[model samples]
Target: MDAMTSKGKPSPRSSVRPLSNEQVARLGERHNLVDVTRYYPNGPRMPDAPEIGAQNPRATARLLEGVSIVMRQRSRVKAWGYDRVPTNGPFIVACTHVAMYDVFIPMMSIFHQGRRPRFMAKAEMATWPLIGRWFQLVGMQPVERGSGKALAIESESIRILASGRPLTLWPEGTLTRDPQKWPMSLKPGVGIIALEASRRLGREVPLHCSATWGAASINQWWPWPRRNVVSCFDDRLPYGDLLKDMGAWGDEPPKELVDELVRRVHLRLVALLAEIRGEEPPAEGYWDFRTMTRKPWPQDFDWRIGSSALATETPTDGVIGESGVDPGLNMVDKGAQS
Candidate 1:
């Protein structure tokens, strides 16, 4: 049985519960808004523009300048957790994609924090007018989708991390088609890259997930009364345990391990989004991009549970044995509870 809208069309199920006027107002009070248009140009600048590998320095500067102009004139940006970003070293930032313009929010936020991380974007973005060419010149790794070259992409991502550079990726692969704009199921390549790169470098890579809200409400054409855009960057997600058994698995990590890693990233993004929106995520479940349906949340799973409680007890053969429990939550780490 499916739900129907007043127009007699089937309504898509959503996990997001809408917020009331009072709730939205209360959430609004917590933000410390900065009018980017007024403050950005005069604000403290990064001591020196960190080199972005082989990217064209002049082009990267110009591209960022243009992005700053558009963002400042169109919206106010509020971001936190920059201090949590490692000042130096290799790290991965997986961010949520709510809207097209939202990409710049995290890009600028990371730049402001004085780290110049390369970004993974669709290959088509390299062809966009005005900024497309600049994107390529500014460390954008263009991903060619559905081309049967996933391994190549994954290798390149791992290479970047192994080279001691920061990498930012929108793991959802595209703007979320979630009816409520919540993050959808992520591509497994993010998990694969994180795990493989760590093995190559002999340490767990610092992986962070970030969520942004407010840009979706803005009309890019006639921007005014600048919307309050807020972004939250989480500290490193707990994944050291995932790497402990890597040696036993030989070359390819098990599908179950990769899937569990992806699950953790998805859950973390969902939690961060809930905090930013001040609305609880759909308790019913998360949206599945492939099936275009809402799946039930893992049985007894709580978004507030610490990372340890979220770890999966991955079984061999890449499938969860029937224990009548969600494989993703078969075991809870009592020691890791927050």
Candidate 2:
């Protein structure tokens, strides 16, 4: 199934075969030949002028400038499909978390393209030394996990969308613990916020899935020859079908529908990352954050039930302690929301 044509259905397991040795070598050659100066002179231009947000102008300018300088000295960043990103109004950006630094790739790309999006990030970031205040100044919505305020956090995210501003989030919540670094099972909060906000606004919120690769190859300590970093802003994922029956379900969306939405997002990210790396993802399955192991696509998994199961059955399953609260419910980290 084409990754971009998911009409509110789960994407089929990938059937694309791995690239051949010669093909892989050719891909590498193309990246190595890229001229950073050509693309680095200015950020990718958007077809429509960017819709500015409520961020502090000076702070946003300085933050973008500082990030651009550091990225230029470290790696060459190239992006595609800027035209696919919506030029105006409220939308959601669900990006893959390959590395901590990869967040800047999308942030800079979007800022340069002409829209300033408010990003969801861990609340602790707001308490950091100097940069903490800077983060809050430049559209960082703090996500306080395990606080029993899952509904409040979701409400805040929906409010941002309702206000007609773009919101970016990393659904995985944390740096991928996936052994191979591919995106893993995503927290369900992204699905919840999107579906809820769309219902409230009387329209389906445009959701875009982005993937970045090659950051893992960089060594932060001793940087020599810069590596090639590439990002793909995929066509807006179609999710209008999910809202067709919204009037029937009162108040909150059903858990099953939310799970399905999360599944589609995960599958799209996998396909996009696969294209970037020119390699096939593991056929076995995606890494489950709670389990810390590879497993096939969950067919009957319920986010709330899964969290409760982990709490009672396997106390030592994953990072979060025995709270048993679903990460989807509370721990959904909007990674590096700048």
Instruction: List, residue by residue over 1-338, the lDDT tens digit for candidate 1.
Output: 01110111122323433333454456557644333322122234322233442456556556666787888777766666554556567789999988766678777766555457888888888999888888887778988775466788888999999998889998887778777778887889889999998888877777888888777777667768776677767666767778888888788778888998898899888877877777677877898876788998767556665242432323333211211322343222212111
Alpha-carbon runs more than 4 Å astray in model 1: 1-54, 305-338
Q: Residue 85 error for model 1, in Å?
A: 1.7
lDDT by residue for model 2 over 196-262, one digit each (tens)? 8888888878777888877776768865577667776766666666888888878898888898788
| CA-lDDT, candidates in order | 0.68, 0.67
Q: Pick the lDDT winner.
A: 1
In candidate 1, residue 199 scores what lDDT?
Answer: 86
lDDT of 1 at 273: 81
Give the Cα error of residue 238 in candidate 1, in Å. 1.8
